[model samples]
Target: MAENQGFIGSIVETVKTVFWALVIAGIFRTLFFQPFWIPSGSMKDTLLIGDFLFVNKMAYGYSYASCPAIRIERIGIDLGPDDFCGWFEDRDGRLFGSEPERGDIVVFRHPVTGRDFIKRLIGLPGDRIQMKDGLLHINDTPVEIEDAGIFAEVMAPQGPLGLRPQCANGAVGEGATCEKEKAIETLPNGVSHSILNIGRRSADNTGVFTVPADQFFFVGDNRDNSTDSRFPQAAGGVGFVDRKDLVGRADRVMFSSAGRSMLAFWTWRSDRYFKALE
Candidate 1:
């Protein structure tokens, strides 16, 4: 009976600890820092294929509830049929000091499915955004580009997600579909940054779209490889996101990984960690 009582006491303590730990995390993630993982190369060669990142939930503002579309969790509840009611209730509204600015790297909930997405802000309300021949234009003005040298491939030495460094023969299976070009982009505000253009095949390179009030346009640096505001994915609509869908601006690159290969640890580059996004 004594031994049994000891085991039960340990189990009870463990459960209580776990419960409180989760409670604290829920409070933090809901109103403070939230973690995110990159699962695709859609944002490469900037974000790469396997970068684990933390999205600042409070960078735009803190919340005690949830964004409307996602509401993946409410307070501390996991999303489920029974949790839907809470999702709509007690939504943690924004605590922003100001609206998101142009050129701010942002994390936003996909308007189509309420999923989170990180992209560069390119257009704002009352702006005319058009893609011409693989170039971005805003308000009938073309975004200027200055030639920058090719981006050197950086190697990732270690991470839970093993990514091999970029190489001539790196396992980017769809290499044929990607094109790399180096350029310095200057937005209207003179916010300039180096950009890698994947190819000139982006579907966005043809038409004009007017950003609606309280909406913004965004794109990935990988151009053709990104399915951003260009395609009509059933899960996410094509082009433009409302201010409400935007969660927070991407402040920095945090860290990037090569890909899924253990032999490539030597390929890791230490210089790129925590680099500013733009």
Candidate 2:
């Protein structure tokens, strides 16, 4: 009887430990924060592949993951990736406190594939958004573009860098290129970034859609590479993010994998560290 009781006690303790761990993980995954990885070049020059981002689940509050099933109640729902990614749950009833603002970088779930994506907010509801000659126009206002010199992508004839070049100075992420093959465009909002407008390589998208209520229109900073609302939702895009599906407002890029990882310490890039998701 004593041995049996001891065995039972051990089992109970293990169960308790597991329960607490799961509860903590669930809470972290649902209410406070969640982790995401960049898997595509759709948002290149902004977010590279292998970059990990911490999604602020609290930003869009009342996470749909907290709800066990379809609930009749309305307030204080718990939403996790499951609901945000549209895996198990069909719809989450979370409402609005503040809508996604223009020029805000956001990570929303894809409408068609139900995958998470990150992009910049360009147009708001009731705004006329159009792309002309590869330039973005909001309400017919041409966003200002300033050329911050030319930007050239350098390949080490390999990955990010196989050997630290002689010109490698000013620490990592500070950039050491004296020449680039592209030009950087800074918008009127003081948001400056680079785009690879190689040739008249055809953006292949031209249309205008009204931003629906409680929804937002997004585009990638790497306008040419990003697969955003510019394309129809049928083309595996992050179409008009619904309020309920707004997983979180991207506050900051806590960290990012510098796209290339090598065993040689010199190959490790310290850039994109603690970068804000602007």
Top lDDT hit: 1
Most TM-score-accurate candidate: 1
lDDT of each: 0.64, 0.60
TM-score of 1: 0.76
* TM-score per candidate, chains pooled: 0.76, 0.71
lDDT for residue 187 in candidate 2, whole number 0-100: 56
Q: Write the per-residue lDDT of candidate 1 for residues 1-278, one digit (tens) a residue.
A: 99999999999999999999988876666655566656655566557555656666666664322332234344764452124334433343455646677887777766655567877888889888888887889988899999875655444432444433333333454233223566888999988766776444646465777878877888877666566776655635546776656566556656654545424665454566787666
The residue ranges of model 1 lying beyond 4 angstroms of the native Cα positions read 62-93, 152-179, 202-204, 233-237, 261-269
